[model samples]
Target: MLRVGVVGVGNMGRHHARIYSELSKEGEVEFVGVADANLERAKEVASQFKTKAFGDYRELIGRVDAVSIAVPTSLHKQVALEFIENGVSVLVEKPIAESIESAQEIIRAAKKNNVTLMVGHVERFNPGVLKLKEILDENLIGKVVTLTAKRVGPLPPQIKDVGVIIDLAVHDIDVMSFLLERNVRKVYARAGSAKNPLELEDYAIIMLDFENATGVVETNWLTPHKVRTLSVVGTEGIAELNYITQKLILYNHEWVKEAKVQFKEPLRNELEHFVECVKKEEKPLVNGEEGLHALMVAIKALESANKDEAIDVEFT
Candidate 1:
């Protein structure tokens, strides 16, 4: 059985632990344990999962074959490097790291250790997104013209390290790149703090220009109700996706169609794919390089917001 553990049993981390625990009962994998900086929190989660808990994440380095690191953005590199150097595969939460440099370091460490490294761009596993990808591949939308996404909600108390661009807009940025199959050529953005002001911005509107398509991402922490949706307009028709409900709708001159999709918990699908990759020694759908590119675009968006001008995106 594939042995697995999770570090940082916070909001998202706890879900990872729960999924692994359920998968363990099926005999396909073993839920080794969990670790968190907050010892009490770790103990509480471990109790729920009926597994061991550790105060230091490093304790699981040698014991588990794979680990899911859900710590804050700042600690991503530090924690990922430790486990990678110990030859443990890792599935790290989104945005990879705070900066491109740190992301590159994590990628290099995983490569040097020859371990599987996957980023938790969980939206990629959303049933609606999966179906949308297939529809695009079929050219149902014809040549894409524009993609727009809005991800807005009240400020999450747990978020403190990064702004809307990195924490929220990155999802749309990654999704846009995935659908368009091209790197961002330029980024123009405007961001500021209105409610729940911290060191980072809490509101942002980003416009991305690609080779043949354009994307707009609107994210904020001030909206009272949560909204997660995206729309794609192409030559043939327009398609809408609701991230929360996993719903897809198509609109054309002749007809309006609702695409049928089998809904599954995105986190479950993500964790399952990570485990499969570890077992088969295969590359994940969202690999280290893709993660880094997303980070680069996010960083550029921040720069564009600060400079009040469009910035050219340079990918390595």
Candidate 2:
């Protein structure tokens, strides 16, 4: 059995803890412990799962074979590097880190330690997205010409670590990159603090140019209602996905009509994959390199926004 530990117990962190606990009872994984900077929260979570709790993650690293780092974006490198140094595999929450330099350091550390390094780009595991990707890969949508995604929600309390681009739009950016299977050639973006008072941008719009397609992503933390939706257009058909509703609508010439499908919960599947990866010692579907690429794209978008010019993306 592979022992697993989760660091952080906030909104998303708490969800990770709960999922891990349930997966353990289902015999998919072994929950070892949970850690958080807030000792009380860690203790509370540990009590719920009947596992050990620690205020510092170091205490749990040696006891577990792998860890899920759900800490803040600014601390990703520090916390993940510690676990990697101790030869513990890690599944870190998305965006990797605030800078490419830090992301590369963590990637190098994971490679040097010969440990599995995964990024928590949970959307890719969504059933609706998975099905949609299958259709796109099969050429149901025929060569995608353009795509757009809008993710807007009310602003949460400030974390002051990263801007909205990295915090939110990175999800769509990564998803688009995965679906298109091509590097973004140029990017343009504009953003600022619209609702909350912080150094990070609270609202933003990014435009991307690809070799065969173009894409746009508008992310804001100042919307009245939570909205997460994406639309992909191609020469033959179109696909629309409502992430909040877990519904996918496709219009294809083969069907001569539109077809709709509903998706079950995606978080459960994402956690299940993590459990399987830990037990089987397999690389994750979304690895650290993918997360780094997303970060690189976001950084260039921000640079474009600041300079009021289009920025080019450099890939390795």
Candidate 3:
């Protein structure tokens, strides 16, 4: 069995620890422990999971075979590198890292050590998104011309390291690319801050130009209620997906069809996939390169907003 541990049991990481604990109890992986900078918080989560706790994440280095690192975006490279250098596979949360340089650094170290590096782009594991992929692959919608997503809600207290583009839009940016199977050629974005205490942008509209299609994402934190949805318009039909409900609808010139979808926790699916990949000695669905590509597109989107012009994605 794979010995797994988690670092940073905060908003996102707590769930990782919980799921790992469940998987361990279910005879999948052995959940070694959890770590956090806050000793008290680490103890609390470890108590909840019935596992050991580490005040310092480095303590988990040699004990576990793989780790799920849910630290802040800025600390991703550091925490992940620690495990990688120790011959432990790591699954770091989304955006990979704060900048292109750090992301590349993590990727390089993973390659050098021959470690399995995974990024927690967990939305791709959503049942609704999986169903949408099936519909697209089956050509239920013809050539996709435009794909738009709306992901808006009040800002989580846990988000302090990044703005809406990096914090929120990256999900859709990665999803759009995954669905369209194309790389962003150019990116343009408009963003501003209203409610964020740190003055980070709370709302953004990003436009991504792919080789044959266009992708748009509306993300914000000022909304009173959450709304997570995606719309795909193609030559022959249009599709809509409700992320929260895991519902999908397709509309063509002939009829409107509601497709049945299995609802599962995205985080559990993501962690399960990570566990299986490690067990089978295989690559994760969202590997380091895919994570880096999404990060590059996100950086370009931010740059596009700052310069008020579309930026070409040549950095990737």
Candidate 1 segments whose C-alpha is farther than 4 A from its true place:
none
**Pairs in clash, predicted candidate 3:** none
Q: Let me know the TM-score candidate 2 reaches against the reference structure.
A: 0.95
For residue 212, what is the lDDT in candidate 1?
A: 96
lDDT of 2 by residue, 136-172 (tens): 9999888999999999998767366787899889899
**What TM-score against the true fold does each predicted structure earn?**
0.99, 0.95, 0.98
Report the Cα lDDT for residue 71, model 2.
Answer: 91
Please list the residue runs of candidate 2 whose C-alpha ends up more than 4 Å from where it truly belongs after superposition.
252-262
The local distance difference test score of model 1 is 0.94
Tens digit of per-residue lDDT, candidate 3, span 10-83: 99999999999999899999999999999999999999999999999999988999999999999998888889
lDDT of 1 by residue, 1-316 (tens): 8999999999999999999999999887899999999999999999999899999998897789999999999999999999999999999999899999999999999999999999999998898999999999999978899999999999989988998889989899999999989999999999998876576798999999999999999999989999999999999999999999999999989999999999999999999999999999999999999999888999999999999999999996
Error of 3 at 233 (Å): 0.3
Which candidate ranks first by lDDT, i.e. highest?
A: 1
Q: What is the model-wide C-alpha lDDT for candidate 2? A: 0.86
Report the error of model 1 at residue 122, Å. 0.4
Error of 2 at 9 (Å): 0.9
